[model samples]
Target: MTDKSEYKDSFRCGYVAVLGRPNVGKSTLMNHILGQKVSITSRKPQTTRHRVLGIYTDDDAQILFVDTPGIHRKEARSINRYMNRAASSSMADVDVLLFVVDGTQWTDDDELVLEKLSHAKGKKVLFVNKVDKLADKEEVLPHIAHITEQCDFDAVFPGSALRGHNLDELTKTLKQWLPEGDLFYPEDYITDRSERFMAAELIREKLMRSLGEEIPYSSTVEIEQFKFNDKGILTISGLILVERSGQKAIIIGKGGQRLKQIGRDARIEMEELFDSKVFLELWVKVKDGWADDERALKSLGYDDYR
Candidate 1:
């Protein structure tokens, strides 16, 4: 029988950063791995604007997964620069760098992501995401081989974040790479971010999904007020910042129907997440060029995670 000391030798705990270009499913992978929605997801690129920490703890390991904004070449806006910096800085001192990419398609943004990964100090693992979309499973080998030649990744894994394929194997490999240490968070804890932060993200996600493609990128969400009553009912007031008066009109829609829909959808999700009744008030305010202004971005909570 194995001794307790021997068992202790197998324990591991450390931070793992999930990185990739926009729309590569980094957030999806983290959310699926943790079995909770700590980060928001959308069909649109750059849906994640901040660095989100998803904590996973078990008997053998505690992996703090850092879900970073997708790195891209777009630094025209201050928010874009902030996101790139957030993703880049998260790789520092991390135990594992899990670089995810789309198996169906690879773009110049992906190459940019790889360039950033090259400079990271952590042990790297290449995740070829969305293999479930492949016409034939055998196509993955050549694709994996092609990426493996680009860098010195410790391991190359192929899986679908949406379908939950090979995630267990990826988790096992990540645990093996972690150093032996005690858990950084309690067993039941799943994220380091506050519920207030999550409420803002959830509202932003609903807005992103509801708005047209042209309007989503020019918007951001901020939680102005969050309070819980004695009856366990949570009240949240959020401000959605847009870059133009035109965008604000679009968000508000005819007779305020669009804004009401956004609030209703976001409130439903918040209730389920907090496990209590929730009242969410959403207001769309135009802050011209806020995404381009570093000071305004900081005020809206874009600079806090850094």
Candidate 2:
């Protein structure tokens, strides 16, 4: 066998940022890679509002992967401002940048990402995501080449985030790019976020998934309590805050049936995540245009000063 020092020189460690436009499966990809729910997933745009870090480690390398919000060009608004800044700030002091894009097209939105990636300090690897829909995987090469021409990157990878396809290679490549360094987090560890935050996010995800777009976008979930017992029982109370009383009625539904459904679904997933029985209570309250309120935004953890 090679000497211990020689072995150390061959190992790698670094940070990889998963970035893309809204609903491009960036959150799904992060959850899949980390094999846990570090970020929330939704069909809606700008689902992730914070910088989520997921750690991956093996004998040959260690990776600190940052899951960023969907990279979108936006106008004045509290939500947009925070999402944009959260995603952008993760770019600093990173070893590599993984600029994720939907593989199906080469829209103007993609060009905007290219512009942002152009200014990033480190090397990049472009991933063409959502490839499961392709009639033939080979069809994306032309688009890949087009992006490659515009942005200089170490390599271009094509994969489906929804499926497990190409993830092994992508992970291997990302590990290879990093220089030798100490592990950032323990091998068994996966994410930096707390269970409380994740519980609230799961409630939000259920709302977004079960309810229609109009209500989901106008919604936010806050956790009031999260406690568990050795008997494998967990209790979580969440506030489903909406923008209007009309929306609140829609959320509560007939005899509070809709709220029950949302809580049921969220609790099931929480049980699976925590490996315990969960008692989830959901309350719907109209925040009355709190989306525009700076204090409401700050309380929800969208404080841009981070």
Would you estimate the TM-scores of all the predictions? 0.95, 0.92
> What number of clashing residue pairs does each candidate have, in the order they appear?
0, 0
Query: Which residue ranges in model 2 land beyond 4 Å of their true spot?
Result: 1-10, 136-138, 229-232
Which lDDT tens digits does candidate 2 get at residues 182-213? 66666667787788988988888888888877
| Candidate 2 residue-pair clash tally | 0
Q: For candidate 1, lDDT tens digit of each residue in 1-306?
A: 122343355778899999999998999999999998999999999999999999987678889999999899968888889999999889888999999999857788888888878777979999999998988888888877777788789998889998999999999999999998766777788998999999989988988899888799999888889999898889899999898899999999999999999999998889889999998888989888988988988888788555
When summed lDDT is taken over every stretch of 10 residues in candidate 1, the lowest stretch is 1-10
| Candidate 2 residue-wise lDDT at 306 | 63
